[model samples]
Target: MTSFILFAALLIVAVIAILLPPLLRAPKPSTGADHREANLAIFRDQLAELERERENGSLALADFEQAQNELQRRLLDEVQPAASAPSETRPGRKTALALLVVLPLAAAGGYALLGNQQALDPLQRQARITPQQIEGMVAGLVEKLKENPDDSKGWLMLARSYKVLERFPQAAEAYGRAGALVDQNPELLADYAEVLSRSQGGDLQGKPTELVERALKIDPNEPQALLLAGAAASDRQQFALAADYWARLLAQIEPGSEEAKALAAAVERARAIAAQGAAAAPAGQTAVANGSAVSGEVTLSGEVAGQASPDDVLFVFARPDEGPRMPLAATRARVGDLPLRFRFDDSMALAGGKKLSDFKTVSIEARVAKAGKAQSSSGDLFGTLSGVKPGSQGLRLLIDQVQP
Candidate 1:
């Protein structure tokens, strides 16, 4: 708008320069002294000619005199001052005013027709299609990936785009393909795990855990693994374990970082739970007995922890530090060294059985041979064998139910 106004002003000034001089000049004013001089010179020449003519007996004195007087009158008329005329106020001011108004008006018209209309129409139209355009763009990306399947980066991008579009199956396929291209990449594995976990409704894919382990091995302090581990441990009711993972993550980040603050706050919450437990020990014991066994079938179900890597089993012994360190007696069923199930009953109290009922509190510790281990989980335990009666439907934590 400002530019238009400026242009209009300049145009008006240019037009005024072209028109003003002619409009203001006196158009038909009479000639004065210079004209008179020229006229007198002509008259004198004529008189001289007449004198020569008389000397040569070509004209009579009376005729010569009449001609002379006529010429003299013409010369005098030429020499006389021009007729007096009132000079109306110069037209320059009016011309300037006209240009000032007209140019701005023209400029405004041009601005409305050219700038506003032409510039804004396209912008508004483009804005209207923005959402669809984004979706279409992602679709195009996936299509391109189909044509060039070998491009790892392209596959990764397409997978992420598919996830954004909520095409879970396609996203999983794309992520899988990308993983194949870039094997052992912790970040890629982590990203894959996130997608798989979401697509499977919180069920960690076989590959994600493997990736998590690999990532931890690659970078012991990887925040994502720590966070995932913390959440997983928390889900298993390992409050202290969760705190450990979260605290480790927070320590790695800058103290003032937002992530650091958030993780720190989470750790604090875990600590509060621990404190609450400590405070309500007697009251909690009356209700939550540690020595009892569950009566009903717990339907133990979970993937075998060491099926893929038996040497890296992370068995958690959930028991209080002050109590008999040997856990309450329990029977573990192993299918060829793969933890298949755990049986808790009266017969589980022997020296050979895993003592499951003695501890007032429980947590887990796993030996991970990988370079890095996952941090404590923030997720709550599905159930704990911590407080079971001697003959109650105690917890039968299915290995298959373990969700990380």
Candidate 2:
């Protein structure tokens, strides 16, 4: 409708231009001195000629009449004035001035009615930075934080950057400081756990695990919490737990996305680990496999952390300190402040093909940290295989001063 109005207005202006010129008639011309002089000059010349002819006795009545008529015709021709000079260049040039005023106003009014101001806005036209560019920016922020640690926001950005870099420990430390600065945010806590796990030498057995659990408690459905929980569970051989965590995380992950694909792979890994444990059961030995609990007899023959003497505390508690306390899974003859060979002699209670009895698996961390928390939070299994496994020989692990 507005377009039609504008078009009609322009058409009206055009019709005015086409129709107005003829209606606005020019003023009538008045006789001036030049016109009178021109007429009188022709009349005088004819009269003077007639008088001279009469004096010379050559004038006749018919000749006089014809001569007078010729004189009148000459006078009329002489007095025919030129058309009056135009008052202005192209009559009524003021119309053009009116046009000049009207065109801009029309344009402005049209814009007010029809134009999309958002499209014309400079900010709206500005180009957006790509995700890769943003990631790069985060990286630079991290570098700046490394140089100048005082900037809290920069540290947070750096922490996020480290997460992108997969440098978990550094990310955790940065995130921890960020958390301290901003008062225990759930996201920061989650990032802290994630990085701390890798920081403690790729094992979530230490500082990272606790943070993850605490973070989860704060926010149950936190994406980071789910991801980290899955990782921690798998590390501890809690395959079913790992599967559940990852499956929950998959729901949060964008469908058919790279993160979803990665989580899916983790889920499959958990399933495989669970299947291996399930398949380890013997056909007729289900009673023994299902019935026998691990009898942890782990004997630490080494110096316990913060203890006054080797005899201060019994070896049984500290030797298989990390995982589930199975009575048959204890260590023996572990020397003080020395490398101890922890044996897994669960043959008495653990029948063949029973849990962990058949598999030659990885060593459980029986070593104690300075804080007396088990180095491995869950009890570490003896090996990483499924077979009729004997106790690990020449087993050695170093115990450093664990951070508080």
Best by TM-score: 1
In order, candidate lDDTs are 0.55, 0.55
Q: In angstroms, give how far residue 227 of model 1 lies from its true place.
A: 3.9
lDDT per residue, candidate 1, 46-147, as tens digits?
989988998888899898889889888876666554333344455666775676578757866887777655444555446454557868988788778779
lDDT of 2 by residue, 1-404 (tens): 45555785687677667755654545456456576786687689878989788778799867877888888887666656443333435444566556556765786688779987665566776887776886788767767766887887777877777777676767777776674653456677776776777677777766676777666556645678768877877787767566655665565555579987887888888768876876785765544444332322233322334432342211221122234333223222222434344333332221011244543442344433222222232322221211222343443444432223
> Which RMSD values do the candidates have, in order?
17.2, 21.9
Superposition TM-score, candidate 1 onto the true structure: 0.47
Q: 275, model 2: CA deviation in Å?
A: 2.0
Question: In model 1, what lDDT does residue 390 have?
Answer: 45
Per-residue error for 149 in candidate 1, Å, reads 2.2
Instruction: Tell me the lDDT of candidate 1.
Output: 0.55
